[model samples]
Target: MVTLDWTATEIALSLGISPVGCAEISGYKTWVNVANEGLADAVDVGRRQQPSLEAIRKLQPDLILTSRYRHASIARALGEIAPVHLIDDQENEDDMLASVYQSAHQAGAALSRSDDVARLLESFDGEIEKLRTGHAGQVEGRKLVVAQPLPGVPRLRAFAPNAAISGLLRKIGFADGSQMSAQPFGFATVDLEGLASLENDSTLFILGEAIPDDLLHASLWPMLPIVAQGNVRLTGIPSWPFGSTASLKHLARQIVTRFV
Candidate 1:
């Protein structure tokens, strides 16, 4: 089998299928765990922007997994090689966790591993319960702002109330501190001043990388309540904020690991 989408590859691997071919970008360190375990012997299909059609044909995979958002246009061409299972993310766009599970179930069904999907979700639930128990006091009635600091850029990518990360944070017991109006993509650009406007008790979840030193020492930085209270949590774990089950699981684990 071959996976043209990174999220699909993650689900496939969680279901115990080692794809014969995978898109190159899916092998990044953000997905290191899955790549090392499931893609150790997979063929790289070149860059996602310009995947090698010839390489795919050489693999002769029985199935090609893709997503409607990224691969709908290529579905026809990819179908010529094998059956293309397009994972539609927009159907459950408003509910990211549901969309993730739906995508996982789709992959599991295709791979005849629905049982594995169920088990994975069960484990995720258990882990979440543990995290909720462990951080019961810190998160109760508390709000948080989950943002991605764009390296070299002065602005931050703040997760809107509709974002997947925001949804997860709310589920784990923190309220959304972004307080921004909802958008289709579930994110808004904000500067330090914008962040400062949020409630002081609101913690911060900075995803992907740490705040650059210049920003850390900025005159405005010390003024933020989170910074003053030492509530700024940095998660250097590379992850797709809008990713699938495995990525979500990885994120949940990172949160638990950091707090514990």
Candidate 2:
């Protein structure tokens, strides 16, 4: 049986292959509700950033699959115990696609279900293309404000060219604010007083792990006119707003159907 770290765990779930055990990451208990419940019996390898090697060793997995984004060195360390596949997410869309496809195949091999990955990718191909075609002229040259929410952190991240969220943004023809590209800032702290500094036509899109309850609970909801104006878009995926290719496909489809 394979022991999956959070990234692999997400892909495994997407590919419909459940691992024998997995690392319990910050986002899983909250965001990946279905996968967490379905794999309740699986052993938790601890947090994704700091996995419990002692516990991982106890699971005795045949292969250890961890993502490279937040844990490249950790994957190397885990390799000493078992065959580790440390994938780099630094590449472009084609590179990411390769990684996802290869990771799916590797996951299938580990679970002895190689065909599942191919079928899943095939099923998604048509949907992805349709979205691209549909949104071709609709979203052309629109401005977007991708905001990241952090309760205490002073900075918020916006979309970038290499970022997964930005990848979808580009396809949809959404142009990010230059400031959003240079630096990230919080939404709550950035009211109209701050937004007044930017162009008026910039559309708003919110992305984060979990926004503070205060944003909704307090008087802040009505105070933020951009959101009140129905321009705020929430990304369901935790990482990069749209972290994975699977999610990228979702955004493409949604943009074509709704935004465009």
TM-score for each predicted model, relative to the true structure:
0.88, 0.69
lDDT tens readout by residue for model 1, 114-170: 888889888777877777777878666677777877777666788888777677767
Candidate 2 wrong stretches, greater than 4 Å? 2-4, 33-38, 91-119, 135-138, 153-155, 177-198, 208-230, 235-242, 251-260
lDDT of each: 0.75, 0.57
- TM-score, cand. 1 vs. native: 0.88
Residue 176, model 2: Cα distance from true site in angstroms: 3.9
* Local error of candidate 1 at residue 209 (angstroms): 5.1
User: Which numbered prediction scores highest in TM-score against the true structure?
Assistant: 1
Q: Candidate 2: minimum summed lDDT over ten consecutive residues — where?
A: 180-189
Candidate 1 Cα misplacement greater than 4 A, ranges: 25-27, 217-219, 257-260
Q: What is candidate 2's lDDT per residue for 49-117, written digit by digit as tens? A: 788888878877777776666677677678777778654443334324444455556656665566876
